[model samples]
Target: MSEENKQIAQELIDAVGGLENISSVAHCATRLRIMVKDKEKIDQNRAEDIDKVKGAYYNAGQYQVIFGTGTVNRIYEQFIALGAPESTKSEQKEETKKQGNKFQQIIRTFGDIFVPIIPVLVATGLFMGLRGLVTQEEILALFGTSPDALSDNFMLYTQVLTDTAFAFLPALVAWSAFRVFGGSPVIGIVLGLMLVNPELPNAYAVGEGEADPLMFLGFIPVVGYQGSVLPAFIAGFLGAKLEKWLRQRVAESLDLILTPFLTLLIMITGALLVIGPIFSAVEAAIMAGTTFVLQLPFGLSGLLVGGLHQVIVITGVHHIFNLFEIQLLADDGMNPFNALITAGIAAQGGAALAVALKTRSKKLKALAFPSSISAFLGITEPAIFGVNLRYIKPFAMALIGGAAGGFFAALFNLEASGMAITVIPGSLLYVYDFVPLMLYVITNVIALGTAFVLTWMFGFSDKMLEEVKTE
Candidate 1:
């Protein structure tokens, strides 16, 4: 490692309050995820204030500090240099289980697990969308008049890659969460796999009308904990605690065989019997609350599509909406969330594009442009972080544009036939749906274009661009 890199990493560790303060640490493709014992100890606002720090968030039980691509590696090297091991720590012997503030803990745990996995999820989602284009019969039929004979290879390939992520994602999250809580990753992975595996469908009663499949052990009362953002987190938290408790009682010599076996037995059982019900109730309540909000008198659909979508984007829990969309499609023949996401993407992209054109700083313009373009294509993370997020004006512009778009969609009583991107080419499959294909295309284009125009007219400042670029 370069001495300079080591020095920077050490400084980061020190700034965050030494290696001991860390419960667990990991990195995504771009950010460093640090789970600390106490959020109060770290100056989150100060970290964000640093010119070098791109963004910082405290969510789902984890404290996240974002750095551009290469920063995580540098931080990791420094962590090693400071004699702090990269692997998770052994489970701490004693934890007070009196259950503190339940809501806050759940949020923190959710953040720790989900924020790091977002890049992979987005990549896979985009890939799945592309694969649909390659395999759709009508698309291929357009090329060669034989609709029925269109090849399934593209669809198959996409399905396999996409399913691999979805099928095993619980395991992936569990591994990350366990590490966050400072426990054995292997055991956590096993627990996650158990939750998502289809063959052993765990059953959960989600009220009177719905019987949601738990998809793990039948013992859990919560439904569809598989691929669930919260349950995996709760499982990891409980799993880590259970593992630690077992580790203390077993003799050192028999630890190797007994520790894992006993931990698995206890954690899995505990998860199914206790943790699942509690988490399921919480999930049910949140969904119920959101649904209730959508029933409000003040154009509930527009408010939800515009306001809640923004909140989810910031917390990075927006991915949860994908599952909800799929569920709605399967159950209700329509999905409001899908429409909202499409509109949100258009709004965000438009705002970024507007800012890009108005900014005189060549570097800021360069960064903002590509990020905005990608946002139009339905991947908004880059734009959200690199462009619109910090620019107060752009985000507001996007939200207003999004609200306008979503309100139009709801007014027309539009419904997507399937999950598809809002872009012109991607909306081809929804051509025959309740909302005409032409309207869908025009709505997104207008929303995005209007946002860009408004951003330029009201929010543009070359000085602001220069300040951001120089910093």
Candidate 2:
């Protein structure tokens, strides 16, 4: 660690009660989340005032001190060096599960399940966007070929690159959910695969009436769960619980065979007969509602979604939006959701930069600058948690900025070909058209500039810096 980081780490340890009060220490993307034995022992204000500490808050029995990305890991290492008990993410999760209320535990479970699976979707979304770009008429015209005239092998390659993840999405969801719920991921994956078996008609094909659903017991219809999420999650949860129950009852010698066998058989039957149909209907309803909201007149949908999207992120349920975006891409080949989401993300960056420019403390500036840059490059957690949300007015200004940008995006009917990756990288999703591309740029500029100007005008002051320095 750098000398500066080491100094900041020692200061942080002192501010948080010199390590004695901390039961366990862990770090996430941008914060040192410490479970303290006694919250009263820590100097919360002093922690927030520390050089590298951007903000501090207590939530769900953990004291989270914002340190911003690379800095957090170093601080965490420093804690370990100081003999603090290190905690893994799973352990922290279990701690929260034990301490939090039912709703909080459910949200935490969702975060645990989805956080690990997001990278796969993000990578796939990027490939999907690039595939759209390469196949666009303008790009293809450069190669002197129309869509029909493109080489079959080239199209085959693109299909392989882009379609595989969506085709097997259920398995991915099931595996992650199983891991989160404390079940064997391999068994979960097998159960997920069975839901999407080749023997059954594909979900999309069934929807399009191109194939028939399989009849079970003369009347119950069963279809493959291709591109589905909810059924897999439900199946994984029930399967995990069932597996545990079976393990407790069955003899240890027979557990290896009977546990998985019964878990698969019972879960698969339940999925096909109950979970799939019910949750599929529920998912359809949600998609319809989201589509209707986004389609509202005069850009109202965009304004509302863009302004409050980050609030959803704060609640840790934003991963649910992934399902909506993926469904939009599957059904319509366009995702307006990405444009609005980008507006919100860009606004956060703008607000953070404003705070960076306004703050007199070199430490605050250092923390805010890279986080702003990260936000523009399609990651906003550092910006939001480390800077903007730390100050209430900046967050509010960012929301207004996002609203303005989103209104424009909706007015232009701007859409992206992919679900993930925003701001500069999001441009790839709009490469098919020059108008949409320019609109994307304009949206980001409006978001960033508005937030920057608003924050500069009202978000920060000399008084706040004086207080920090004194602390």
Candidate 1 per-residue C-alpha lDDT over 73-174 given as tens digits, one digit per residue, 9 for 90 to 100: 777666676776454312221121112366544544555555666556545545544555555566666687453564587446667865565556668777
Deviation in Å, model 2, residue 252 alpha carbon? 2.5
List runs of model 2 lying over 4 Å from the truth.
1-6, 330-333, 467-471
Scored by lDDT, model 1 comes in at 0.63
Q: TM-scores for all candidates?
A: 0.60, 0.92
Total backbone collisions for each predicted model: 11, 0
Instruction: For candidate 2, write residues 292-356 as lDDT tens digits.
Output: 99998999987998899998887655866776886776666678999998999999999999999
Worst 10 residues of 1 by lDDT: 89-98
For candidate 2, the 10 contiguous residues with the lowest summed lDDT are 462-471
By TM-score, how accurate is candidate 1?
Answer: 0.60
| Candidate 1, RMSD to the unseen true structure | 8.1
